[model samples]
Target chain A: MNGKYWVPAVISVALMLGACGSTKERNPAGGTVPTQTSEPYTDRIAPAPAPVDGSYDAAAAAERALSTNIIYFDFDDSTIKPEYQGVIDAFASYLNANPTARVRLEGHADERGTREYNVGLGERRANAVQSALLAKGVSAQQISVISYGEERPADPGHDEAAWAKNRRVQIIRQ
Target chain B: MKSIRYWTALLLLAAFPAAHAELEITVTGGAEAPLPIAIVPFSQVPDVQLDIAQVVENDLVRSGRFRALPRRDMLQRPNTPAQVDAATWRAQGIDNVVVGQVARSDTGYFARFFLIDSISGQQIMGYDVPARSIDQMRYVAHQIADLIYEKLLGQPGYFNTKIAYVSATGLSHQRTFQLIVADSDGENPRVVATSREPLMSPAWSPDRKQLAYVGYERGRSAVYLHTLATGEVKRLVSERGINGSPVFSPDGRYLALTLSFENNPDIYIIDLRSGTRRRLTDHYGIDTEPAWSPDGTKIAFTSDRGGQPQIYEIGIEGGDPRRLTFQGRQNLRPSYSPDGRSLVLVNLEGGRYRIGLLDLATGDMRLLSDGPLDESPSFAPGGAVVIYATQGARGAELATVSVDGRVRQSLRQASGDVREPAWSPLIR
Candidate 1:
């Protein structure tokens, strides 16, 4: 049993490292399935396309995505959905290239549960994103996390659409 | 520079009486057969603006125990027990009657009220409460209600109490949070503190002199102890991570709070006098929203260790935590009733978050509030009512429900969303 577990763990680690180094699997179509490793722990967010020329502005590319810089989650969950990997990839790569650039991950929850518990939930969401960014090799110094619980809402409506928008981690560039 | 400007503006706003947004309370539900009582419009000597008798009537009606007979229905306006005609009120099916008179003296004012049982034709209780000014008459009225409540029902009345809550306005970065303390009837709202950042979890000191609450400074959570009399705030705890849920122990010497610095969020108790701390729980799951039992020997808290958030009780000396709530999808924010036999908490069932009362001995849970979203349950001083936060038509607002789950009232403000209501202990 020990040998069986060890063989799969080693293979999974190898696949994760390969997925991190090779750029061919980048999800260009913007779908839920991330093109990187399927493993939840070491899944690398595929960064934005590599700059081709000297005039290419990585800051400009990140700015456009950061304009609507939001990553949403399911009800009462902190697992960064696969669809938000592209947004996280843009943030991680931009922060990695620009070490001086700092961002605050403001996590929020919908007004469903108790307030303090939502604060914990929000922190978990922010920490989840922070882990994702760190797994992609973004410097820890460039990222900070704060959870606003259900105090701040992207949409104040009581329906699921508003709650879905509110359960989010906002990447705020500072 | 922006932070400085915001602090300066907050100080200026706190220095004076900010917007007076009185809570408009509407009784939504009440007992099936309420005791019919008549509160005659009190006769005034100098004709004061504040109606002391009306205030008392509103207080009693809101409790759902008493149904105040309208002034129009009164056959006579009696100002004293001597003037009360028991036969007339008894004929009208009013079992009891409250009559009062407010007289202005050279010093200030004197309000005298009489609670008489029409069935017995005897005065139940009477009191002459002095008010320094007209502004204090409402408080005097609440005192009268409390006396009558205790005399009639044999339970301490919560009328002469206060509630501290967070009122938030604006959206996003422009949001302004004000910690407001108002009378139990939602009158005399005074802004205790203002913050550009979010403020939550207002806990009342046992003496009712100070409040310990969670406020964010520079986008990080910190707990502060604010002296109500001096308007001075002491930053009590600002650990590296998650310093929130500041609840005062029954004796007021310690504060049971949740700090995440060690790792994940866990319950801890801080010796307020010594400024020292001790860890209570070491769970990886979120362990927060701690409440001290009235005896201060045990603490009840919300923890998700059982795969979902539920109420758990543990000894103050750190022992095996016993799970207290087994019903609902989740139960959070456990607050012991003053009697310490039960806990009032936010119970989520069938996707609807409502206020729930849990019996400690039987482990039976009963849903209280009818809610799509109702949270933050705190028992009133007497444990007769539980004031919680619920989503109102305008936005979030403060509400109260009797422990029996009969009386329901919605306290709404003209503006801002109100949440996290902490009912204060009875003022001596």
Candidate 2:
């Protein structure tokens, strides 16, 4: 099937969502502007100043970023929040540096709306991460995505606190 | 049109024995003036195990259409039409009476019941149904109830139908998901398929012989078709992205499903015999949960094309979608009523998700459930009630409400999260 027939429409839609995403990024009064962009994400995962064995530990740096494997999302929104950019940068850098390493992005949503629609939302969230990694020059073959929708939730509670945690994309190393 | 199924070239797996899960039901509200009737306990041989009259009474009462006269109020229990005391029933304010008996036969057991119009003192109808074994007696009870329901209500009964749903047990990583099939009342639960990953979106085939569901394996998701009688499983589709929301066409010739194979979710139809597929919706926004019209010429699905999720209907040949719901802030999962007069859906109103019905002719919607979180509404075969999943005290459980927004019921399992309920069409 020529899925490209709808590319023009998809791009316009993506542009609209992108605009919304940036609008959501603006801080309201009294809200703290996240310091994610103030510091280089790599610096947080930089190698140790002086290793006991005098050897560089690349895995340690990657581990710092990979440790927070889950990227959370706003309610009913698949656009990646600025705060999760650090986690995405670490995974992207690691995947780009090691083309052989594979990862499966498991996307999830809160128990809201219908189940099947959440599956689509989950896929969109995973695809967002996939697009981020591709932008960092990671091989597409090293990444796969699956949407668990509302089936798998990080927190099984019904409140907003749980919903915030449930709306996430988990990066699982394979 | 209904397609006839031939059992040729099918695989049978005898190992999938049925496992039972107890479902507790609580009914509330009823018809304004329910038909007053009496269901006398069926005379039966020893060791029948189930009370046939009680099951029938429960079914009628659950419909909110009949108020069964309690046995304690009856002067006598009649085992046949000839034995029914019409004058006594009339005095009891019961216009109709049901009488039946079960007896052992050379092959197995036979149950017969008669419906007598107490006012006229005449037999209206009667049926003799055979049960090959004791275990089949419950099913026979449901069949008898269906017969009585249709005879009295002038429509097909869903009492004899089955309900397919996804049940999740355990917690967190230890969670186990099962695709279960149970009687309409949520009894006789059988695990059609089980997985450690996750199972969702279980849909019943038109003929009621198979179920299509989404299951995950090895961290990847796929759609599967499961043959109930045979326990044989077939992986229907597993595209690169989301492969889910599979629903059978009314004629069973094709399946309308949601696929994100092109990197975005959209509705697609797959030809079962040829394995060829054609895209139905090319929306950039999510277009999923496709439900077929009873005649199979149109499909109604949930979409976010207008910024908020709403139900949309499109022709099978692919065309501009028409939005069908605007009353709610959001609506998803569009399941059509059997008569095609209305669509039962999950409507989001006042920040709460509830089951709502949209009248196709009047273009009006009304809430059917009072909910903080209620979803996945499916209509019964006769379109009398809508079954949906709601968050209960323990976890998610199944519940039902009459189409008129009167009767309500909660079908809860002893343990586990039961959801994604799809009511089967009447098999016969």
Candidate 3:
């Protein structure tokens, strides 16, 4: 059993080292190094750390893991982009680790379509994120979704930049 | 994008009082040649509150049909038939002359007016309107305008009608919303509902006494019925998921709305008397924005079952829906005309949304608005013009255009975005 687990563990460590080295070169302007080294290193030798009561706040964990809270989409599309996968993965992991964690996904859309139809599009975007979390082993009870559509726009302008910013899903801890 | 902030600041300066923001109207397009008329200022007693003649003149001028002659150009200020000099008005090329007066009565103020045909010097019509209070003078002025409109233009007048819309303020997170009711001319605005959460989709009942709208009071969407007379609100529907896009049937017996409790947004109708809901569409894709036909036999809605949003019609008894639009890339938010012969909807073409009028009998669609983003197309009581929400320099504003696309007018609020305009039926 030890040998079977060691092979995959070694491969994961090698991948992490490669990722860490590339990130350092790409962002060499005094940016702090990615600080998620505790999990992989400890999982290889010791049992997983038990979740602490009252200390595991899903919101703080999310803030530390991701640089931004907004996940954007293409025009009239709700599919999650590959660039946002890491952010979502971090959130899903945090949710799975803490059984009491709960989140509300507020979805929105650009003001290009009709209001009612945009409401439907916004809901679809939020549900897309919810499905991703569910597939990552997060319980349905931990997630609730609401769509504001184009009603509450982050940037209230009539241009491409504003439209891009408005079409996003914001994850809020409950 | 920088211009938006500047425009917003300018609008904020003009916005105040929180409860009511009188909209300023700008007429962009109208008849090629407006019929010139003279609306002499009404002579009033000391106690009367409002400028009744000015209100009447503004209504006729905004209608895009009649042009009131400048008071400076008028040769005389006539308040009765005896003071009228028809030859002088005809010499100035005026077609009609309006004269009026407001005097005090035992109960309240009384107004008498007359419309004269300039060529014949004959009184075409006249009335003695009584006002119960000073505040009702504006409404009395609108009634006089409606009478003149119907007499000269040969069509039903919509001047005395009311409009319901949603007004929003504040930034993204700290937003406040209000459902407001105002006159068609953007006067006498009253806040019917206010919430920290989002409020949208205000639909008036047939009697014009109740409004059905979607509110997020419980952290999730639910439909609420608000009685205008009593200021009473009751939650009509609150399921697990979305409850939005509430529209009343013609007879006020049912409400068609969109519900997503089963994880799919579909059209559902609730019997107002029985409180029973019946699902209208079972499609996996979205089906929302239900509009009842004038006869209450069919319902028009927006659906994406065909891969893109388009208008579809389904019978009230429930059956297969027939697609009503195929030309636009996407079509939604359909509202039936008062005559039930056509529909006005938001059509997406070339990535820009505009209001389009689709005639059911001829299958011909006419683009009625020139704005890039126009939505919530609702027909006026007379079906001669459509009022819709459009994006302006300062944010969303209300605009109206004739069905022939000739006359256009924009209603601009001082602050916040005013949207989802629903024109009420002619008040009894």
Candidate 4:
């Protein structure tokens, strides 16, 4: 079961490097680029950046993708949203390239439900991300998962906007 | 430097309030009109610091079943039965009158009180209570209130019991969590545990000598049992995956908790003395929040096996799980009432989460709270009231509602969020 994931992990690392090199060549002045790409791998194989307007800068877009660590989820669900999958893929590539790299996934939920059950939901979310990374050839030993439930919130407001930010899995590099 | 800062923060929290600030309660709803009553100022040879009559009055008022007459309305102060003028109280439309006196005794402060029927002009009940110190005087008042409640309402009073809750202050990264135990009326709040990470799911042992809760001290969820008298904390489980929702059995012999070491959350029971764990649920779906039935024969918990979160019950020895809830979008956090006939849980309905009570026999559920975001419904000792956490204007505050859902009161802190209220069992 464990051996099946190593091949994709190696391929994702190659894809990660290729994408980074391509972005640098396209924009020398370090400007932001449109997140979307027309390549076929963008849809099925790898996390494709979102489509943006012509005014988008390539360099800034690349930096934002690389720096973004938090992955948000839908209400009461653990499946990684399509938009956030790219963020998880970036971390997976970084960890696969540097085998010794370690990161901690801290899962959180909003203050809408019971605390303990939210903890379980948070764990499921974190584990979902961990599974994605592991499938990308990131060693299980290099990653850890912890669920903070609704105890920690990125936005403390009780409204939907705040709750959307609170139900997230934060990837912290160790 | 980090250790120093942590200790400094701990010291600041300790210094801020060794005892919990009295929770300001506001009664919002009630089914029946409150009975008019007066608690006369307790006469003392040398007046004590504690206001025994006021504490009793607050307890009665918070119950939403009694209307304590204003002290100014009392025509005269009476300390004994002989001094009581029932006709005067009856003229004032008072139904009952309580009069007491505090006197220094050989062991401690001795308190003697009498409950009088204003209309009948007869003493209904009388008792003498002893307190070791001024701090206990508050508890003495609670005891008196309990007696009065039982006599008039025919239900056990929760005033003399204690409550455990999690208090969070600050924001996000700098948030501080304190596991606090306070009197039922929100007095004498003591910090039993503190951590920069979250501490939650506080369940009092049957004996009230310890608390079993989940803490994130090591950056991962772990179940911990904290002994109150000795200040001793023992970590019961800290495995690779989740270790959350540790609740003691009715007999206090075992702790039912959730662990996901196998990559799926499941319910497990751990014997406290032998340290043996028995897995109860082996399903792939999430199985957590294990609440023991009052008889200890069955365990009710929240599970998502039915496609959405719902309450389910299984025997102690483990068997086919029976689904217990179906009316809401999701149902979670099931806590059995003392009688074991019904359970209270958080039910998501119409996009708003509220507290719901489920009848075990008939499988009928009733929504008991009207708040938008109410959670963690725990039954008071006698099943007369259910205390839960509700989101208020300032932050999350504690609220209590009667079983009939007519009477409601909110216990708000001065600042910070106070939640996860677990009412202690009746303390003799």
Residue pairs clashing in model 3 are none
lDDT of 4 by residue, B278-345 (tens): 89999988899999999999999999998889999999999999998989899999999988989999
How large an RMSD does model 1 have? Answer: 13.4
Error of 4 at A134 (Å): 1.9
Query: Which pairs of residues collide in model 2?
Result: none
First chain TM-score in every candidate?
0.66, 0.68, 0.64, 0.63
- Per candidate, the number of residue pairs that clash is 0, 0, 0, 9
Model 4 chain A lDDT-worst window of ten: A50-59
CAPRI-style grade of the A/B interface in model 3 = acceptable
Question: Each model's C-alpha lDDT?
Answer: 0.86, 0.86, 0.85, 0.85
Deviation in Å, model 3, residue B28 alpha carbon = 1.8
Best by DockQ: 2
| Candidate order by decreasing DockQ | 2, 4, 1, 3
lDDT of 4 by residue, A1-174 (tens): 233344455566677766675763354445565444455222232356333333234333444566888888899999987887789778877787689989999998988878888888899999999999998889999999998888889998989999999999999888
Worst 10 residues of 1 chain A by lDDT: A49-58
Lowest summed lDDT across 10 adjacent residues in model 3 chain B is found at B5-14
Query: What is each candidate's DockQ, to 2 decimals?
Result: 0.49, 0.59, 0.47, 0.58
Task: List model 2 lDDT by residue over B22-89, tens digit each.
Answer: 67889999989989999999999997979999999998898888999988888999898889889999
